[model samples]
Target: GGGTGMIGDPGGKTAERVLLDAETVARNAEAIATQASTLFAGADFTLLNNADWLSQLNMIEFLREVGKHFTVNVLLQRDFIKDRVKDPEHGISYTEFSYALLQAYDYLHLHREYGCDLQIGGSDQWGNIVSGVDFIRRKTGNTVHAFTWPLLTDKAGKKFGKSESGAIWLDPAKTSPFAFYQFWLNAEDESLGEYLLKMTMLSKTEIGAALELHKRDPKERHGQQLLAREATTLVHGAEEAAKAEQVSQVLFGEGTLEGLDADALQMLKAGAPSREIQTGTGIVDALVVARLASSKREARQFLADESVLLNGDPITDPSETLGSDDFYNGLALLKRGKRNICVLILK
Candidate 1:
């Protein structure tokens, strides 16, 4: 089944959401369905609109069936509602207050139509799932099961699947497959063992073997690579995963500028820290602009040490002005010391 795209559930102490426009909700629903199809290929699925039934219900009928079962005292006592309502900065809204009832009615509708018995969600959703179950029991005298997986977190106690940039989105346009792979590949050594087994559908024995290899040589990043490959392949498909790996190797490994085209070069450049240099600016000025070195003095020091690369060639002359010819077919490669490389595409 597809997601309901609910506007704002009264489950958290957050600001009232700007409800999505009809067109925006439609687009989001389509994207969600596409992602779900990838994860659950060949499975029977139904995309239902809660508004279909919800809008049709009159006040009297809703009060008689669903609303009668819920008590104001009990609803007010719910931790989520209490906390949200108590918060001065982000007080709850009336629309949000009725969110639980709408969700419960959704469950009742689905159960009556499809005979759906189980609901699964993240640990944070336990309260909502149980509320649905309670509504079904009260209305139809039927028992329903609900299950939740504990929310995953990293070793540092931060939420999983998020980075400094933002959420690791499933859409390739939002987040490239290369970036997705790199995220998993760079997972911490401490959490690698448990994360590999839990996050992906890899067999337990395979996971154990990968863990053993990881312990044997942590620097090799065996487990991390596997996690990246498996997860990326699952989400973006095998072919895209292979390309992502290739791009990663060329950028991070011994592979150099010759292997990358203009597009690939641009993608690689995006991964590195970068700065802009105006046309005809000198290499020293470019270095200063990039903040690769603190000042002109340090820029000179780096140049003297043969630490700067212009289009993959070391320039000993600090005074050398960057010309159109210095660019690699159209892009200028900038490097500080040797480990960090960025590309400057002429705009």
Candidate 2:
């Protein structure tokens, strides 16, 4: 994705891409390399950046070597290309139009250099992929195979990563492990089976069994839980997955906050409402501050009803105070009933 990242892939776009600067492309390439290395750990593979060759090509030489094989008529016949060409406001750019040739050259280069014979990508890349296959056959007269799977889409038919919220990045900095785990955990029931089958490394037998179990009680979300756990473990590692799961359980009242540290509690900031308050804040005031109760009167009523729990202990006394002992590692888990929860971070 080195050179290709600069000119974004126009597979499913309605408009031309804003080209990236060289530095941004390099940074993105490095990030992608790191993620690929982490995800494909223990697999036998060599990572190669197409920029290694693409960046060194002479225009005239490349036109003679590769461009001549591709025809405008064939390129325009592609669905994406055709769509772009039909658009009056945002016609395709020559840079993007030439992507197929570059990709075709990539396949040829890999086949010649690394003896790589197979190219795989999403169904969106079928046109570009076949272009590569045709290029290789023409250049070296050697046959190569290509395969593509259907694009992963949610229930709304939008591609998985292109959500309205924004792209779900693999980088932990861009999207936290907890957020990433939650994204899968909140997957729609209709899409759960496809997500489990495609996203995780679970076998068919295991998936079938899980689906069967999930069918008995969809409310339990056994399938989603499994998918979330497996997907999070694959991307962020087992420890991070465990941490995310722990935070999730504590938030849902299925687990305790006993072992949760500041890091684990931090994950709750996204799932549960939180506020900062000094230690020794009155229980009534704390509940109000947490938005679990509308006012001091409401807070007191909740406390009087024995519905409020401070660190999982029912607090019936409105006069009770939250002190340093109430906080675990600068964080306190406050619960009102089973559904509503809030975190108080000591200021």
* Index of the highest-TM-score prediction: 2
Compared with the true structure, what per-residue lDDT tens digits does model 1 show for residues 30-71? 777778888677788876666677667787987888889998
Q: Candidate 2: lDDT over CA atoms?
A: 0.87
**Model 2, 22-54: lDDT tens per residue?**
999999899888999999999998998988888
Please tell me which predicted candidate would have the highest lDDT against the true structure: 2
Worst ten in a row by lDDT for model 1? 1-10
Provide the lDDT at 302 for model 2: 91
lDDT of each: 0.76, 0.87
